[model samples]
Target: MKDNGSTKYDLLIERLCETFGALYQGVTIDKNWLCERFGIAERTAYRDLARLAHVLDEVSNGRFKLTANLLPSLHMGHLAEFANFAGVAHLFPHHDGQSLRKRMNNADNIAIHGASSRENQQYGDLMNSLDKAMTDRTEVTCFYRGKSRRLQPYRLINHYGLWYLAAVEQGRLKSFELARIAQFAATQIAFEPDASIIEELDTTSGIRFGKRTDVTLHVSAHAATFVTRRPLFPAQRLLKEHEDGSITIATAISDQNTLFRWLRYWLPDIRIVAPATLSTAFMKDLQARCEPTTSEQPQDA
Candidate 1:
C-alpha cells in the first residue's frame, strides 16, 4: 500500500526539527548525517528543511542545535563563557526576590509545603514511576537497595516516610526499602498484578505509607509504658506483655527514621529486634554522633 503523504511529511519534519535542535554553527548537517541519524534520503531531509532551515539558522546563528537526546561532539563554550551566550542565559532566568540559597534549599525539601514537592529529585522520580505504573500497568525491574535485596523492582509502595518495593520472584513475597534502591528502569514486560500485592501492602506496610515491612520490637517498661503514654505512630500496637513489664511492640515501617528518632527519645528502653536494617542504621548514626568533635577557634577574634 502507498504511504499517506501528509503523515510522511509530518514524520519527516519531526525528524528534521529534532536534528536541528542539536546542530551547532561550526558543524554542517549533510546528506550523510541525515542517513546516519534517521536513515532517510538526502532528498527527503533537504525537502523537509526547505520550509524551516532559514528560520532555524536565523534563530540559532549556526550554534549548536537539536534537542534530541544524542549530542554531536561540537565544543560548547567553556564554563565561564557558557553564561555569556544568550541561549545559555535564557536557561536560567533571574527572579525578582528569593535568594539562590533559599531556592536551592526549597528544591532539596522531600516534602515541601506539606504536599511532597516535585522539587525533590528522588520524590519526583518515584512519583513519576508510580504514576506510570498505575496508569500503564508496565512491569518494572528496579535496583532496589532495601536491606533485603538489590536491583530488583516488582512493586511500588511507600511507608511512613520511606519508600518500599514488593516482589514475588520465586513463590515467596518479599518487601524492600526504597532508600536502598540504587536505580530502576521500567521494563516493557506487562503483568496482571496480584490482589495479594495490595493485601500484603496494607497488612505488612505501616498504617501510613504502605511500606510492607514490619518489626516486632522487644521493649521494657520504659518503652512499653511510653508507647502507651504517647505512641510513636498509630501502627505501633502492644502485642504481648510479660509479668515483668516487658512487652513486644509490633511496629511496621520501611526505614529506621521513625524507630530511630523515637527510640532516641527513649534512650535505653526500646530494643529493635526483627528488622536488622533499621537497627544497623540507628547504631551507625548514633556511633558517629557520639564520637566528640574538636572545637574551632575564630580567626577574627
Candidate 2:
C-alpha cells in the first residue's frame, strides 16, 4: 500500500538508519512497527535491517548506534559547534539572525573552539573598527570624551587580554584603551598622498612613553611578605625568600607609577630587593616626610 511512488529503496535506507539508531539505545526495532511507520512490507523491513547493520559496520567499526565517537572523526573544538547547533535547531529563544532557514543551515555547518581565549571582549570590537579604518585608511575621530578630536587610524593590538588602538592625532601617535573609550565612531576626515608619517610617537605595547626605560631598585635585606604569596605579575617568578624572611618578588610592570606607590605602602611589610636605586628613592621620600619642622614657641627654657 504505497502512494508516494518515488524510490522505495531510499525510504527503506532512511527507515533502517533510524531503526538501528533507536535500537542502539535499547529500543526494540520490530518489523511490524517498521511496516506501520514506512508503509512497507514485512519483507522490505528485514532487507532494510540488513543494510543498516552493514552501513554501521562500514562507517564506525561497530562503535556508533545513534551518535558516533566524535573524537575519531572531529576536533574537540567542533563539540561546541554541535552544542550551538542543537540550541538553535531547538528554535532560537531570540532571533538575532536574518533567516530562520539559513540559521538552521548555519547550525548544521558550525565549527567552534572548545577552549576559551583570554582576549577581552572588546578585543573583537576593536579588531572590527580597525578593519573598517584600515579599509578606509582615514582620519577617524573616535569619541574619547567631550570634543571629538580627529585621528589617523592605525593598527589594533591584542595583548594579554587587553585591547589597544594605536592611532595618530595631530601628527602624534596615541594608544587608547578600548575599555576606557566612552564611544568609538570613525569620522570621515581622511588622508591621501600622505608623505608625512610620525615615527617617534609610534605607540606599541600599550605604552604612551614609547621609550625603553632603565630602572633601578633597592631592598631591605630583612623585609618579607611574599614568603607565602603567589607571583604578583604574569611574568613574575619566585626567585627566593632568604633565610632572614626577606622575599624577592620578581615582576615587570607596564607602568611604574602604581608600582612605586604600592612599594611605599608595603613598606615594613616588604621591600624592593633589587636594582638599589628605587630603594634609595623610597628612603629619600620617607626621610623627607619625617623631617622635624622649625616652628617652636619657648616653653620653660
Candidate 3:
C-alpha cells in the first residue's frame, strides 16, 4: 500500500521511538541501517538522524550513539514528551529537566521537605474538562463559592503546591482556587483570548491578579537575617537597611488577605510601616483572636 500522510507520520513516530530506545540502551545505529530497517530513502534516514544530532555523536565512520553528557537530558526530554502526549503534563509545573535528572541521580545527598495541598481524585474529570476548554478557547460555567460563574479560562496555575485557575470573569482577571470550583461545564460559547490578560498572567508573580496596592514593611533585626536571605512576599524589594540591622522592604499585594497571612506568620518581627489602616486592622484582628468569644467565656457555676 502507498504511504499516505497519516501512515508516513505514524512510521516516523515508530522509527523515532525505536531509535530513542536503542540509543537509551547504548546501542549504536547507523543511517544505512536505519534506512534498511524502516525501508526509507537515504535522505529520509539522514533527516531522521539529523533530528537527534544534538544528542548523538558519531562513534565510527557510519555508527552513532547517544552523547554521554546529554543522556540524562535526553531521558528527561523523552519523559516530558510522553507526558505531553498523554495530556497529563499539566499535573506538574515546568522545571529544568536536566537539573531534575541530576537531583534524581544524586538522591542520596538530597532531602526535600515541604507542605503541599491535599489531592482529591474527584477533581480529575473537572481538570480534564477545564484543560480541553482552555485549549479550545471555549467559555465555561462553573459554580465557584456556591455561585454560578461564567469564565474564560486562561491558565491552570500551581502556586506553592496549590492549584488555581487564572481566568477572566466579567472582564476582570481573577484566580479561582481549583478545589472550590464545582458544577463545571464547558459552554458552547467561544471567546477570543485577550493578549493583555495572557501577558498579565505570565508576568504576575503569584495567583493574585489585577491592580495591586503598594505596602511598605519594617523587618525587625530579629527577622532581618531570614528576610534578607530570601524574599517572602510578592514582588518584594529591599528598600534600605537600618543602622540597627533592621531592614525596610516594600511589596505589592493585590489581596489584603495574602498580606495579612504573611504578617501573621512573621508576627512580632514584621510590621506594616506605611499603611496605618492595614496595621490597625491587623492589630484589631489579632486582639479579637486573643480575646475570648462568647462561646469560650466562663459559664456561671
Candidate 4:
C-alpha cells in the first residue's frame, strides 16, 4: 500500500534514524540491506543513503560506514544537512550547526526560562489530519470556537510559542488557535490552493490574520539604540535614522491591541508618527488611564 502524506515523512525520519544508528555502531550498511529492512524499493533506499553521502564513506561491496572523523563526535553539520533534507530544519531555532551543537554540549552554561510552546500531543491527530488535507489540497470541516466551519486548510503556524491553523473561511484568511479547534475531518472535496494565500502566510510575521495596516513610529534618541538592536514588531523596517540619534521605523500590524500594548511598554520614548488618528487615540487612552478613579478621590475629613 502507498504511504500517505504524513506516513511518508514518518518513514523517512525512521529510515534516517536507523541508518545513523547502524553507522554509529560501526556497522556497514548497503542499499540492499536498507531496502530489505525498511521494506522500501531499492531506488528509495538509494535516495535515502544519498542524502547522507557527505558523511558516509564506502566500505567495499556497496556497503558504507560513517566517515572516521564523524565517529569521534556527532558532526552537527552533517546532521543539520540531513535535517534540511528531511524538511525539519525549521523545527530548530538556530540555523547554524555550530551554535546548535554548542548549546547541546554546554548544557550547564545555559539558563533557559520562558513560556515554551505546549507539546502537540493533544493536537497530534488534528495536526495530522490538517497535514494530509493540505498535502492533498482538500477542504476540511471542523468546529472552531463551538461553531462549525468549512475551511480551506492552508498552513499550520506557530507564533509566540502558540500553534494556530491559518486557513480560509468564507474567503477570508483567518487564524484559528489549535487548542480551540475540534471535530476536524477532511472532505473529499478538493480545492486549488491559492498561491497568493500561501505567499501571504509565508510573509505574515504574526498570528493575527486579515488585513494589515502599516504604522510609522518615531523612536527618540534615548530608545533608538534599543529599538534598532532587534526587531520589535512584525515586518519591521527602519525608515530613517536621524543624526540626533533618533530613528524612524515602520511596521505592519493586524491588531490594534498588539500595537497599543507595544506602545504602552515603550511609553514616551516611542510615539506614533503617521496615521495621526492612532497617535491621538493612544494619547487619549494614556490620559484616561492617568485620570483618578472615583474610588481614589479624597474622602471628606
Q: What is the TM-score of each candidate against the true structure?
A: 0.34, 0.38, 0.66, 0.66
Clashes per model (N, Cα, C within 3 A)? 16, 3, 0, 0
**For model 1, where is the 10-residue window of minimal lDDT?**
110-119
lDDT per model vs. reference: 0.58, 0.55, 0.84, 0.84
> Which residue runs of candidate 2 sit more than 4 Å off their true CA positions?
1-75, 78-131, 134-139, 143-174, 179-184, 187-209, 212-229, 234-241, 249-254, 273-277, 283-301
Model 4: residues with Cα > 4 Å off, grouped in runs = 1-78, 81-99, 112-115, 285-301
Query: Per-residue error at 176 for model 4, in Å?
Result: 0.5
Candidate 3 vs candidate 4: the lDDT winner is 4
1-301 per-residue lDDT for model 3 (tens digits): 7669889789889999988876775566888879887898989988998998988899998789888874654466565566565444554455334444565688898675554667757778888998999999999998999799999999988777777899999999999998899888898899998999988887788888988788999999999999878678888899999999999999988888888888889988999997899889889988887899899999999
TM-score winner, 2 or 4: 4
lDDT of 1 by residue, 41-151 (tens): 768756655544554442243232333333444333222144443123333354212232244457755333322422235566765775676567665565543423322
lDDT, model 4: 0.84
Ranking 1 against 4 by lDDT, winner: 4
Score candidate 2 by TM-score against the native.
Answer: 0.38
What are the clashing pairs of model 2? 217-274, 217-275, 217-276
Instruction: Write down the TM-score for model 4.
Output: 0.66
